[model samples]
Target: MDQLLSTDMDLSSAETDQRIHDLSGQKQSGLAWVKANVKEINDWVDRDGFALLRGLNIVSTNQFSTILETIFGEQLSQYIYRSSPRTALRNNIYTTTEYHADQVILQHNENAYSNCWPMRMGFFCVVPAKTGGDTPLADSREVYKQLPEALRNRFEERGIMYVRNYGDIDLPWQEVFQTQSRDDVEAYCWKNDIQCEWFNDGRLQTRQFRPAVMTHPQTGEKVWFNQAHLFHCSAVDTEMPDSIGADYLPRNAYYGDGGEIAKQDIDVINQVYRDLTFSYPWQRNDILLLDNMLYTHGRQAYTGTRKVLVGMAKAAR
Candidate 1:
């Protein structure tokens, strides 16, 4: 599963020749076409941390899954959004949705709450909404660069404390998976091999903890792993009697109320993130790949029916 199947999907003879001609003056590698293409792909990833492999006609889910494993390694299952037969129709009906990182963005790496790190993370948009659902990426490195030294030292020293209240809102995901049995939730936990404390007060609620920072296994880059969603949303319960949103704090960590962090710092980080953000309006058949580690993305609500399919892959170490 880790090794790529040498697919016969290479370009035609003329196409390869043309590509070689285009790169004639450039640094030439021994293996003419494929090697050169590989170098180009690597170069793009080196510069931008991600690449958009356009017009990939992935005909089936199995093929898609194989492709992701080939490219990113074996961690695709942890993050992949396995599309259903009705995925196209369902995505169309829910024409718009707000943006946020993965569920565990609220948790630390796979065992930061338990003792693991995610191998890789990615998403493939099968059908993009009509408007306002652009994938924006902000470099964490840049976000860290803009952090005040004192705040950095505080986070580096004390780290962050995160808490989540799933009881507050009936998230779409919760509802989608909610069943009379609560078995689905239990099954998910079991499959992931993580210990959990579950509740069923006419619904299921779960809480988990993780570290404030993570060290990337390959690059040794340390990423801020504070579960902003929990801290931000929890912190707001203090000053505002009635409000809901993600927030954080450098001082008290998990003060405030309802999981909201601090409004001021949240705004500052959001704005700083906005500075590093890049946007591409949704196109009919566009396919985008993301480096979940390097960039954080969000979505905006939109009108008109939109359909999107998503595939998450692991990152190659």
Candidate 2:
């Protein structure tokens, strides 16, 4: 098998002259070499489904976002506090079951339900999970080609229905997050363009509606997607939820009866993950840039103290 491409080649490009003016790496006076070779640096990312950008200490969110936009385009999602070092460290004390690609199932693409397109995503590992917490990734494009005709037709026509009961899972991380104030939560919702209602009890709630399948804006490849299974909050009753207890929220999915996929289908999908997945055991400095549409990722349970910082950016089309 051909070795997966690595970031060692002399990646110069025609656009390097123009790129110097657009990137901050040149203005700041450090990393001038990277700025001079900007096209090559960016091409490495464009050519690969993902890239492990080693040694660059991405401590500044603004600088990180700039680097991402330079390569991925301008429509990146602004950095938000997905979690803090102090908080993420506390949350990792409790491990959750592994699921591929974001907080949901092993589905392909991001924001499948919405017309809002995502070009790609960046995951910064600030705090790694304890033992056994490796991240597994797979090439969805390969999976798409290898999918059996029968399953392909069924999904092409019907898509997928994802359902989960997040509250029942009793993840401790949820408890730590409950400490957020109404305004803090509302700001978060607003930033993500989530429609939400604020309760008298100081809780903000909302339901997100998005497509279960998505077409890559450029490639036009079809992807199965839905946050219902991953982000458990996808279907929760945002209103009156803080009163009843956070876990009371029910995460569910509805699909055509009889024709809907079942556990058997999930098994097959997971099998694909197992076959195509590449894993990176967390190192404190590891930074992962993922082709959100082309690859899927997951996390596993672990035991030890892992500290990873994450910065998420959407790729540009």
Candidate 3:
């Protein structure tokens, strides 16, 4: 593969350019190249939180899966707790958030609201959108730094509580757990530290308590790790107020003790995310790898067709 080089300075700084590593015009392609440079690529990702590989030959889901396997080893994590609409392509590869073209997906760490989450995640851009559709990234470390002292202290002490009411209006319980049996879903939730209750109408309501800030296992850096802003009722108010009522929204967030998270606080958190976010237009054939604990990612609104496949691995305890 082409020699990877850092394109910018501190990744956490908003003043710096997006970190990208050119992997085009390489001497080797596919598994061979990935196997040889696995350590190097991982080191870059560790230091920068994310790396964008350009000019690779990956075009299909199979090829992307092969590359992911080479980097993350044979076993990869499954999308157990489905939050967004996605179509599974093949072999654990799924289409990136299947939301409407006009919708914006706020920045979040993959599965951050859960007790378990992937340590590493990757995205492959198969087809670039004609307009918009940039996969924006933000440094979680910076997010932590940007938060006000009082807010940070409050979050660390209270943690975060995520509440989901799953049914026809949102994602069905069967689909979220990838099982039709309610017993199986309950079992899965029990093992994952999630509390679940079945409503009289057959809807599933669940709640999970997770840390608002966590120390990265490898780097030991403290990062703002929860999805409170993304899951708060205010998010629905901003995005699709006409379509769903705040109480009927698929998910909402609160303090670990079940206290309401103020909308003003959510607004401040969203602003910090927007301020720290670094976005670049998607280029066809580009592959981006991220340390899920260190960086948060989001999707921008688009006008035309956009095909991006995603895969995750290395589950964090």
**Highest-TM-score candidate:** 3
| Candidate 2 local Cα displacement, residue 4, angstroms | 27
Candidate 3 positional error at 256, Å: 1.1
RMSD of each: 10.9, 10.1, 5.9
lDDT of 1 by residue, 31-114 (tens): 233233655654555556556554444444444444444555443533211111123222112211222211111111222332
How does model 3 score by TM-score? 0.91
Query: After superposing candidate 3, which stretches have Cα over 4 Å from the reference?
Result: 1-18, 238-247
Candidate 2 lDDT tens digits, 112-160: 4333435566555556765555556666677666666676566666543
What is each predicted model's overall lDDT from 0 to 1?
Answer: 0.41, 0.46, 0.82
Best by lDDT: 3
Please say which candidate is ahead in lDDT: 1 or 2.
2
Clashes of each: 30, 19, 0
| Candidate with the larger lDDT of 1 and 3 | 3
